[model samples]
Target chain A: MSFPGLPRMTGWRPIATILILAGAVAATARFAFGLGATTNLSDAFPWGLWIGFDFLGIGLAASGFTIVAAVNLFHAKEYEPIVRPAILTAFIGYLLVVLVLIIDLGRPDHFWHPMVMWNPKSVMCEISWCLMLYTTVLSLEFAPIILEKFNIHAPIKWIHAISLPLMIFGVLLSTLHQSSFGSLYLIVPNRLHALWYTPLLPVLFFVSCIASGISMVILESLILSRGGRDYLPTPLRANLAKIIAVTLAVYTVVRLQDLLARGALRELTTLTYYSLAFYAELLIGFVIPFALLLVERIRTSRRGLYAASLMVVVGFAFNRMNTAITGLEQYPTQTYFPSLIEVFIMLGITAVGFSAFSFIVKHFPIFEGAAVAPGLHHTAVAAQANPGFLSPDGGDLEPS
Target chain B: MSQKKAMLIDVTLCVGCNACQGACKEENQLPPSDEKYLSLTAFTALSKYNDLYIRRMCQHCDVPTCVSVCPVGALTKMEAGPVAYDGEKCIGCRYCLQACPFHVPKYEWSSTQPRIQKCKFCASRLAQGRPPACAEACPTGATKFGDRDGLLAEAAGRISAEPTKFVPRIYGRDDVGGTSMLYISPVPFEQLGFDARLGKTPLPMLTMSALSKVPNVLSVGGVMLGGIWWITNRRSEVQAFEATEKKNRPSRHEDNP
Candidate 1:
């Protein structure tokens, strides 16, 4: 009755199972009783954690296009090793975003209305189309892996034939949508805090997502190496860190310049909650990471990369939250905080994503030279690849 | 039919009475609540700033940002005057709630199938050639209904005739690109809880500047990417051909023999 790629039932499995069950229950309640009963969302604050996390998920997934452009379009063959994993991450990230949207949407059943019913004037309509199209592109980009697993050489060739065009389209779509996320806020200049509101927000969002993407890739690679999976070469890792540092530096300059030009820097002088939030986002997310990654020794070192990348990710999350939630806290009488059910639902989604990623890595040819033989389940491959695999030290026994 | 209707609310004449509230509730058939802000049941609410009582509702702007941002065309500004809502068309994405500078649109959070709730400017009453329920119920001539241009002229006259008794500006004449609901206050409009910071430009114009460049980006980006693809792929193909040719050739000793 066990699934082919399912991991062994372990201590944490029970916890994940509990979270999934709890999430299902919460979803039922939300659907049955409506948003008022299950969520903290109100008339004043319509969007909350779901929208904010959608921004974060989309931002972190930016590496898919970045890596694809580097390897396929720019002819950076050295980056070929990370391409599959990056695409995989993006595919999962986008799927999770859709899931979050469905949960957050008041009419989840009518999610597809935007496809047939067009509103080109609205930035959200543009976002919906981009998300749909880019997801298709990601699927096309990732199709070769599955074809290779099945030993379907003909379709694999077809996939390779269309890959270049697909990557180009993907890059184009990602560029539009990533920037358009910021464009969504442009209409709310009066509501959004002056510290974050500017005409240059779209450009800032595009650049910051690039920095976040590079940092996320670095962080993921480090985690894989520590888990005894296929690790990226030190040279490639160093190169990525350098890219992160450069993008972060550029982002910092543009952001500060925009603030100064808009006279929004004055808002930062006051020690209010919003100003404090702004400083924390800037100093921790941009300045510290930029400084850390600039040093060769730190950028190359394991601890340094982990620390800097983690900071960038945290900062990116904070930025999205600030834009979507904290900045809109204009009325003192009305405030929003996600309910317990909402929190658990988010956790459940994250758990599912993490488990799915682990399962796919174990099953698929995500890592270099890790292809499984045709007609064999991934569990069989894993057992043959490493005997005595039940022990705690089994992962360590695998070749690095 | 030739003239667009408008509401001119003279705050100087308002006495903070609940008649408008009672009338609105009865006309809308909404449940009773003491909510301080607009909600699903309360299409309009009154907020007090010191002795001044201001009625908060949809401004129904000349260039309504909500109608522009509603991906489903659920909200629209009718030519007659009111900004109308079609519940059948609403997917409830709530972009209207966010895009509204006045923060007027309220959600039906309690309903399984929720719709955005706001003042539609009494489209039904207008169709019947009658004033809105609130305007009809007003004991004082505070809330008046008439042609938009005529109302503007009247508002202008009142402000000029008693400059010392009124603020120098018509609140909605140019705020957020001019709303259909006009206001004239004795003290400053800001003191009556109006957002003085709202710019004169229509909010949708801000997003339009960025969205308009989408076509150019797609075409230019497509060409640039195609060029890179061709150049890079061609070089790799040539290198591969050279490598295969090298392998096919005999070794030096074999060739000499």
Candidate 2:
């Protein structure tokens, strides 16, 4: 299976290969045996670990829109080098989320039912439409990279012509879908813990995803930089980290204000599973990472930057899981823990995502991307991505 | 559709017989079993609360949370006062199961092609102007079937007639925008495990508060983003043009020399 220049399947690749295979086996068992036999899901707890994984994956993958909006739409030319890599990360991340969603759905066969059935009032309905559209937008957003690599200039020019409206639509779709994930929880007020429930959920979710998406981009930069060149400069990485700090600060203020207004501040002090989990989520995901990133020295250093970004990513995962599972645990019913099959299937999906990303990066021109491509060609590809931004900063980044 | 049908179950008039549960199983075509809890097999169940047997089933909410949350419109609130489910339309996301405040909707977890199982308030029977199986087999007139307004009047009459026998509040009358199934118990409702704090407004409204804003967000957000893109790029373009002009002015003099 080894290509001539590609690294041989060795080290972590074998483990990933096995995980993917195991996941396929688990998924097959799940469909054949039914949810009851192969999974711990019950009538009382319909949504379990997979739903939490979807939230984390989508939130992290938000780098797709964030980076595109930054370089193409917002006229941030200095950050252009890492744009292709960030978009690829987001593209793969969303594909995994959609895959897990299919497996988690009881009727995966009827997944397209949302397309035919219209329910404008339903949050899930809106999310489904947005997810499908954004994924298409992301692929179109990513199309030029593949096209440029293959020297398919005709479609590249055509894709370029529509790129401005594409970016706008991409951002709009991501904004709606990401926030709607929080809206899904609004109807469950009686069941969801007070500490997690609030009308500000949509806003909180949108802001936090921006922070996490940036963190993911930074982390990818660091990972790619290892034993090679730094994909992004230290100052650039630090600048992005500063944005994370600002987003986190805003998230903290809004969340605390909402909790206080709901009189759920008391629940924070009363020691229990819900309170303890909420504290951990707040501390790890928001407070610690925010505090660390605020320090100028920490934001600039490789180790400090890596640690803070990783914490933000981990903390974000914890918060989503706490909201999905821990917050709903105290309601009158049996507590849920994902079955082994469930765990393996999730691990499998993750393994496939990593394997696919590395394989694409190895074969493609993601890093040595538009920055070095023929100046006129890339200027047309990237500069015109946002209309007004195009003729100004967009042309200067290229050698005219 | 005509005045919306309702069931008023007065606990004071009933024994703890489980006849309603048995009748419900037969009517829904579920397998015969003395299941003590609600499941795919049991649409309704009798759970003991001290000496009183509290009946549990779908309340068939007027604006059901399950119907509002379903992505595929698999669930619908019928005009005749039943919350209905069409398994074919369901993608089986299980969002309905998560959103139901009463936890009434059950999933057929044992089936390869599972569907949500719950009381549809016997929609077909109500459509035929016949009482639901459970209400018809109540034996003691404990479960009275009539129009919602008629049920409300009967419940108020029972409460006033024997003040000591029934609680003044009808469990479904104004809770979560009123349910087709109403309960009038001798004891306070909360003591028997009713979610008394569901509030006066329908549960779907809570979701709508966020979902309804989507259109405004989409339109305004689109226009605002487009404006920002144009303005920011224009500023950069001006800055870049100025820098190039300064460099070329010095070069022009050197060329003449």
CA lDDT of every candidate: 0.83, 0.85
Worst 10 residues of 2 chain A by lDDT: A372-381
Instruction: Summarize candidate 2's per-residue lDDT along B133-161 as a digit string, tens digits.
Output: 99999988888899999999889988999
- Candidate 1 stretches with Cα past 4 Å from truth are A1-12, A152-158, A331-334, A370-400, B32-36, B241-257
Off by over 4 Å in 2: A1-10, A331-333, A372-400
TM-score of every model?
0.90, 0.94
Tens digit of per-residue lDDT, candidate 1, span A1-400: 2233333446767888888888888888889999988999876788898899899999999999998888777767667777877888899999999898988888888888888888788998899899999999888777778877788889666666566667788999999999999999999988888888889888999999998998888888887776554357887888898998899999899999989998888988789888988888988899999999989998879889899999999998888898899898874556678999898888888778777777777767786553321111233334434433334564423242
lDDT for residue B229 in candidate 1, whole number 0-100: 72
Clashing pairs in 2: none
- Please report the candidate that would top DockQ against the real structure: 2
- List model 2 lDDT by residue over A86-114, tens digit each: 88888999999999999988999999988
- Chain A of candidate 1 scores what in TM-score? 0.88
